[model samples]
Target: MRLTFLGTGSAMPTGTRAQSGYLLRHGDETLLVDCGSGVLNALARTDVGYEGVDTVVLTHHHLDHVSDLAVLLKARWLAGETDLTVVGPPGTSDLVEETLAVHEYMQGRLDLTLRDRTTGTFDLAGFTIESMAVRHSMQCFAYRLQPADGGPSVVLSGDTEAFPELIEFADGAAVLVHDCSFPDDVDVSNHPTPTTLGEALAAAEAELGRVYLTHLYPHTEGRHEEMLASLADHYDGQVTFAEDGLTVRVED
Candidate 1:
């Protein structure tokens, strides 16, 4: 499986980064996680497209994570396609309904399957998607995606602070895409700081294979290298700073 980072910026966007969007592809099936601003444009830079994306998994209702959802839905309808499935937290169905309600003209133009997921695993195409409740302001969730064919798994910790449950979500995964919203010394609430992430990684040092930090704020712009060095002390695995358009292949 290959995972591509479409947007690595935080709630606020920078000149180089967009927001929080990632694309996971295995064979013909493609899944998108989070559709922030500029996500569709970012996908244009790659071989993926609205038509090729079969499922969209959302972490929360934060605008930075879901602002462009309506636009994506509209574009798919205009392109004469209709099969799309969305899996997210409790408010996912309501959010989609409200988004479509505002664009009432586009309602019913496409067939959409919305699943309001909280916890546990579900089958999506050929993958087993597991969600865990995360510590965030709003109702948020982190996802663990494992291919049914038995390959390396990936965990995406969407917009969350460092919580004990994260280790469970990332257990035995090949990659952990975590939210590192602030620098090491910059303290914040409901978001992971480098220091907090460091502590978390220290506890799960053996279980993780690779750690990639994303959802960076402008505060972390010039300190990417420093963050990696500090995190390396806690996590023995490869530590990478996620950038827009960055792609990594998962191996078992």
Candidate 2:
């Protein structure tokens, strides 16, 4: 399984990183994890097209996470693609319904499937997805995806606060794409700090092979080394500060 970091920035975008977006690919199946602002353009930068993306899974309804959703739907509709499936939290269906309501042109042009689930496991094409609700300001979820053919598993922490449950959810994952939004001393509530992340990983029952820190804000600028140092104090593992367009292949 291959995971691509389409956007690595936080709610606030930086010059280099876009907002929250990730693309997972297994064979011919492509799953877009989050469709935040600039994600369509980012996907265009890759070999994928908006019309080719048949499945989308969102963690929450935050604008930074779902800003370009309607745009993508419209583009696909215009491209004569009618079938699409959207999976997310409770409000996911409402979000899409409201979006399509505003754009009457694409009303009957596209066949949209909305699945609103919380804290469960489901199958999406060749992937088995396990979802758990995380501690966030809103109703948010973290996803653990495993290939049906017994390939590597990846866990994506959408936008969340530091909690041990998150570690458990990410247990045994080849890659834990966590939301490390700030440094330890930054004192943010709804996001994770390096210290908190290390603590959680240390207490986790499963050994995470690698960790990729994403959803960074400007406060994290020039502090990557500092964050690494802090994380090293608790968890001794391979870690990388994710950047846009960074592709990571998961191995079992």
Residue-wise lDDT of candidate 1 within 72-155, one digit each (tens)?
888777777777888899989999988888877887787889988879988886788888888899999899998877799999
The TM-score that candidate 2 achieves is 0.97
Best by TM-score: 2
Per-candidate Cα lDDT values, in order, are 0.85, 0.89
- In candidate 2, which residue ranges exceed 4 Å CA deviation? none
Model 1 / residue 247 / CA error / Å:
1.2
The residue ranges of model 1 lying beyond 4 angstroms of the native Cα positions read none
- What is the lDDT for 143 in model 1? 91
Residue 25 CA error for candidate 2 (Å)?
0.7
Per-prediction TM-score to the true structure, in the order listed: 0.95, 0.97
- Indicate the TM-score of model 1: 0.95
Best by lDDT: 2
lDDT of predicted model 1: 0.85
